[model samples]
Target: MKQIRLGLYQFGDRLIMRARHDWIVWTLVTAEGQARWREERRFPLTVTAAGIVRDLLAS
Candidate 1:
C-alpha cells in the first residue's frame, strides 16, 4: 500500500490538502507541527496524472 502526497498547504498551523493510487495519504498532524499525534486519511486512485506530474516537478 503505497501512498503519494498530492498537495499540502499550511492553514496558519495545520497542514491539509488532497491526494490519490496507488493512493493518497492525508495526515492531520498536531497544530504545533508534531508528527507523533496525527490522523491519516486514505483516498482511492482517483487523482489526475497532472497532479502527479506537478508533484514530480516539485520533487
Candidate 2:
C-alpha cells in the first residue's frame, strides 16, 4: 500500500503523508504547499486519499 501511494509524492520537493486504518494518523509537514483533494471510489483507496488531503491541509 505504501509503495503504491509513494507515487503521488514522487515529484514533490518534499512529502507529508498519512497512514490510515487501525494505525495512528501520522503527519509530517516540512513545507506549506498547495494540496488538492481526490475523491476515491474504493474504500481502501479513499482512506488513503483522504488521509493525504488531511495531511496536506494540516500543512
Worst 10 residues of 1 by lDDT: 1-10
Candidate 1 error regions (>4 Å): 1-15, 18-21, 36-59
User: Which one wins on TM-score?
Assistant: 1
Model 1, residue 50: distance off in Å is 7.0
- Looking at candidate 2, what is the lDDT of residue 19? 45
In Å, residue 9's CA in model 2 sits off its true spot by 34
Worst 10 residues of 2 by lDDT: 22-31
lDDT of every predicted structure (CA atoms): 0.49, 0.44
Model 2, runs deviating above 4 Å: 1-47
For 1-46, candidate 1 gives per-residue lDDT tens digits of: 4233534334444544445434344455556776432344554333
- How do the residues 1-59 of candidate 2 rate in per-residue lDDT, one tens digit apiece? 32225545434435345445524332323345554333222345435667667778889
